[model samples]
Target: MFASSRKSSLFSSLFQTPHIICRGSSRNRVISGSDIAASSKVSAQWTRLGLSEKKPQEQKPAYATSDQRMASLSELKEIFRKADAVCFDVDSTVIKEEGIDELAKFCGVGDAVAEMTRRAMGGSLTFRAALTERLALIRPTREQVQALITEHPPRLTEGIKELVHKLHQRNIQVFLISGGFHSIVEHVATQLDIPLTNIYANRLKFYFNGEYAGFDETQLTAESGGKGKVIGLLKEKYGFRKIVMVGDGATDMEACPPADGFIGFGGNVTRQQVKEKAKWYITDFEELLRELDSDSIKMNHNDIFY
Candidate 1:
């Protein structure tokens, strides 16, 4: 995705300031003075065509084109090259469904539980509080939860296994931090070759009848910016020079500002806030891995077992 001629210049620009109109990968085409003046005239024309004459900030750059705005994988690759570790969120980030919402579906409270889940994810409600209320409503049977997991396994996002394997090759630790159930993510942790100790997520409690009682509230993810806490903990433990975070939720956004780089995975679900705040936004894991210069590793859906 690199425009070799402009790649270096783009990097230079990006590092020049935190905020600027980034000339995307394909945006380096030369424009003469006449073209620039013509562009300004065109902007004035377009402004006159609008409902109001209020002009937008500097008018659209006459040179900006759809191709120029197209995001390239090279920027992300450069950032990841020096990254020491990447922390991923499980549900929706690595896995497809919100675990509790899936459980709610199995237990006949899908709509209600899903609503709460959305609110929690959308920043309307606290994750821990919502989780408690939802779990209380859908006291699912162990068989049901296990069955759902069996039917719909926790599949890793596209190219995630390859990314993980590449990180492994570099001896960089990968941590799966989630607010989802341990029963599910544990299997995924094993498949991804991440240690159980590195898999920080919520745990479930069951009764003698193999029915769900509730979730363990003691997990770090139950708190606000739980993912950030994990990031902080890892930073303190490993003393790494740089850390990267990858996820697809508000919870993930909390860690974005704290990490050296934050990649938003929009393959499963894309949130506007996440897309806006992430250091990089990608529609799939393949692009993410490719951008990170970690494409050499092989991956498969089986890497994220149920």
Candidate 2:
């Protein structure tokens, strides 16, 4: 889907309105001086455009893009490049679909489960509670789950394979942390070559007869604020000097204090709150891939799996 290294319109997208008119292709676009003035005026209201807020007491630069904090963007990328490990949120971040939502759809309780998931993600309902209620609605049997997997395997986000391969070449460890089921993310890990041991996600329980029983509540990912716990554990376990969490949710944002930094991803889905708060918000993996400086590694896209 992301086959083209198309220029990300993140800035241009936010800059457009009834006033400021942009002309030409997204690449060769042009805006009049009046438009620039309009964009600048709008820049003063970054929060309204879902742009990140300036750090308290930090002066906004006149030269900064309407998104603001151009300097902080550079600072975050420096951290990303130095990171010893990077943790990714599995559903929308690593794959194209939300695993639980997909499972719910497969089980034919899509609408009921999806509403709960929306609230869970928005932080109104605790993740643990949402999962409990959603699972109660799904009650998917082992066979059904397997059938869904075989029929509709997890769709990897475009550019992810290349990105993970690049991280590996940098000798940086990669992890998949998700509120999705273990069975689902394990498949994703296998596809990405991330060690199964590095996969942190919820585990489903089933009866001996292969019927759905429930989920293991003991897993940290089974509850709210679980992703941060996982990041904290990773920090303690590895003693890594720098770790970056990249995802598209509030849960992902919550992982950062435990994680050294958090980079928001929006290639598949953009969470507005995530976009507004992330000091370094990106819509495509290419933005990140460019930051890695591939010249040092000397690898080709063809060798990603090898």
Highest lDDT: which candidate?
A: 2
lDDT of residue 102 for candidate 1: 69
User: Tens digits of per-residue lDDT for model 1 on 73-119?
Assistant: 56555547667787898888776666777667767899998777667
Quote model 2's TM-score.
0.73
RMSD of 1: 18.5
Clashes of 1: 1
lDDT of each: 0.69, 0.78
lDDT of 1: 0.69
- For candidate 2, write residues 106-224 as lDDT tens digits: 88888988777777766677778888888998998877776666667788888999999999988999999999988777777777889889989877777767778788788889888
